[model samples]
Target: MKIAIIGTRGIPNHYGGFEQITEQLATGLVERGHSVTVYNSHNHPNVAKSWKGVSIQHCYDPEHMLGTAGQFVYDLNCIRHARKNNFDVWLFMGYTSSSVWHSFFPKNSIIVSNMDGMEWKRTKYAKTVQRFLKYAEKLAVKHSHFHIADSPAIKDYLDKKYSVNAKFIPYGAVLPAASEEETLRQYNLAKDDYFLLIARMEPENNVEMILDGFSASNCKKNFLVIGKTENKFGKRLVGKYGSDNRIKFLGAIFDQETVHALRANAQLYFHGHSVGGTNPSLLEAMASGSLIAAHDNIFNKAVLGNDAFYFDCAACVKALLEKTVCTETKKTFTRNNTEKIRQQYSWDKIIDAYENYFFECCQSAKNESYVSSKRWACK
Candidate 1:
């Protein structure tokens, strides 16, 4: 099958979850003997025509200059390109900006949209923006041939709200080995010496709350906040807790190997994301055998299950830390989480699921095309 993947920054994945998933999915599909083309942003640092056997097509993205509005134009450009490509399927990763053009999607290709977290419910967006997002989501649901929800909770919500049957297929990750001692030394980090929080310093991520709770804790380990500190929320977090020498705000480390190393050695990995389903970072932390203290939400609960320590507020973070400093020393959670990743969330199984879905959709599409042709001939 010839598949065209859209709605991501690029393949080499200097961006977030969608891009990472696209990189994995596209490359994996290509390796499985399918022709896959991943649409990229022209703004992406790497401008290669192809990366690891997957074809690349760059579209103009002015997010750096126009901000959120630029994404709409970028998606338009991708849609234009996709319409001309005549691919068997178009896999759109998200609906944030692309849903508005849903009606313009190529008629020959079966459109599959991945329903990412409840974007409208995110706390950061304004009321008007949230309403617009809801409308866009509706359009996506109505126009797409199939809905892919990364979490069961998301699938259930979409099914109830739209009265549509959406497929539930969570994101995937590879189980990581132990951290390299040399990699740990580069950051002056040691095995289990620090608690880590790796996420964009956004308000929705509960970044400030995590820092506040850590500051409140009497625990001995350092709290390392990974991700960029240049944003307003990040800078505000620094101003509020920067003086607390215990909190180390190690800004965005993009290298996957480095991130896996950090996760492997962390005493505790705090996943405070409240917006998304099956977060890539959370899976990475689990794969690396990190003991997790995730925000208690249906999304995280579904992924971590009983293997993680849950927290709802600053007090909860403080309590979890205090416990970890003492009796929470057992490696049972880490062992169980790693096993979960190995058994359930491996990328190999995820790619197979996608392959099976693709072929099913393709065969259904062919039958529909045949029926449509017959109707036209009779008319």
Candidate 2:
């Protein structure tokens, strides 16, 4: 099957969850004897003609100049290219802007969309913009031949909201082996001496609440935050909580090995994302064998089960920090989560599931085509 992957900044993941999964899925598909083309943003840092065995097609994206509005233009450009190429499937990773172009999609291709979390519910956008996103989401569901949900919570939401069944394909993470703490030396850190939180700087991520709780805690260990502090929300957080000596803001680190090392060496990894399903960071934390303290929500509960601690506010976090977490307990949590990951979130299993679904959709389309031809002959 000829597959075209659209709706991300580009692959080799300079960004977050979608890009990471896209790179994995595309490369895996190619290895299984399928032709795959991944659309890339012209501004992607590692933009190349091809990476591994997957083909890369760069499109015009002016997001740097026009901000969010430029994404729509980029998606439209990709759609135009896909239409001319006659792909059997167009796998969209997100529909933030492309859903509006549902009518323009080529008739010959099947539309399989991954319905991301409730993007419209994010607190970062204005009310009007959020409303627009909600509308866009509806259109995406209406037009897609099939949709994918990464978590049980998300699958339930779509089933309730649209009364439609979607394919449940969660993201996967690799278990990290212990590596040298070369990156932590720069921040004056050592193994298991600090708490860590790594995520994008956004309102929905609850960076302030995590910092507030860490600052108020009686624990003497440092709290290391690994995200860029140049955003408005990030700057405000620094100004408000910068006085705490125990808190350290180490700006964004994109190196995967360094990220794994940081997670592996931390005493605990805090995840405060309240708006997404199956967060990549959370999976990474689990894979690194780190004890996790995630936000109190269905999404977090669904992933961590009994292996993690939960917190909803600064007070809850402060209280949890006061206790002495024993090594035996940490070891048990790590062992349990590691087993769970192997059983449910392995990369090889995820790749196989995707390939099977893609082939099933193609086969279904062929069957329908055969029936339609017979009906035409009878007429």
Candidate 3:
């Protein structure tokens, strides 16, 4: 099948989760004998026409200059480019900016949208922006021929709200190989001596709350915050907690090896993301065999189940930090999470699920067309 993937910055995965997924999925699909093209931002680091076996289509993106509003222009450019292609399937990675241009999508192609997290619920956006996002979400549902939900909770919400049976396909991760102990030396840290939290310093991610809890706790271990500190919330966090020598604000580290090493060796990994379905970082931490203490929410609970610890507020995080768990329990938590990664969230399994789902959607579209033609003939 000819597939075109949209709604991400680029393919070589210089950015975050959606780009990473696109890189993996596009390459995987190409390897499986399907022609796949990924729409990338012109400013993306990788300027190559192709990476691995997947084709790359670069479009102008002005997000750097225009800020958030530039994303709409970028998506519009990508859609204009995509309108020229006669692809069999067009997979939208998310419905944030592209959904507004749903009318421009190819008339013959099957439109499949991966409805990301509940965007309106995010605390980062203003109320007006949230309302716009909610309207965009509805537009995506009403226009697309099919929907893909990365978590069961999201799927349930879509089914109830829009009366559509969205397919449940979560993100995937790879289990990291054992790393050298020398990696810890660079950070001036010992194995299991520091706590770790890796996420964009966003309000929905609860970075500040986690830091607050850690600062209030009696634990003397260092708490490493691994994300860019240039954002407003991040700078505020740095100012508020920077005085504490134990709370180290290590700026964004994209190196997978270093990140996996940190996750593998940390005493505990805190996942504070309250939005989104099946976060890539949480899966990475699990794949690295990190003992997790996640924010108490349906999204995190749906993935961790009974395997990891849960916390709701700052006090809960503080209590968890101070509380002592036996080595056996720690082993159980890590082991269970890693096992979950191996069985459910492996890259191979995710690729296979997508491959099968795409074929199903194509076949379903064909059948519906045939039925509609038959009714027209009878009329």
RMSD of each: 3.1, 3.2, 3.2
Per-residue lDDT tens digits of candidate 2, residues 1-379? 7899999989899888999999889999899888899999999987678999899999999889998899999999988888888677889998899999987887777789999899999999999999999999999999887789998888899989999898889899988666646777866789889999998899889888888888887889999899998989989988887888888888988888888988988888999999978888898889888899999998889999989889999998998777679888899998999887888898888889888887776676667651122111100
Off by over 4 Å in 3: 370-379
| Pairs with steric clashes in candidate 3 | none
- Local accuracy of candidate 3 as per-residue lDDT tens digits, 1-379: 8899999999788779988889889999889888999999999888999989999999999999999889999999999998898777889999999999987887777889999999899998999999999999999998888999999999999999999999999999998888747789888999989999999999999988888899999999999999998989889989999789999988999889999999999999999999989899999999999999999999999999998999989999999999887899999988998899899998888999988998887778777761122211100
Ranking by lDDT: 3, 2, 1
Q: Of models 1 and 3, which has the larger TM-score?
A: 3
- In candidate 1, what residue range of length 10 has the lowest lDDT sum? 370-379
Task: Score each candidate by Cα lDDT.
Answer: 0.86, 0.87, 0.90
Order the candidate numbers by TM-score, best to worst.
Answer: 3, 2, 1
Candidate 1 has which clashing residue pairs, if any? 227-252
Rate residue 353 of model 2 by lDDT: 87
Candidate 1 TM-score over all chains jointly: 0.95
What is the C-alpha lDDT profile of model 1 across 169-223, one tens digit per residue? Answer: 8889987655478789898988888899999988889988888898998887788
Using TM-score as the measure, which candidate wins?
3
Where model 2 places Cα greater than 4 Å from the true spot, the runs are 368-379
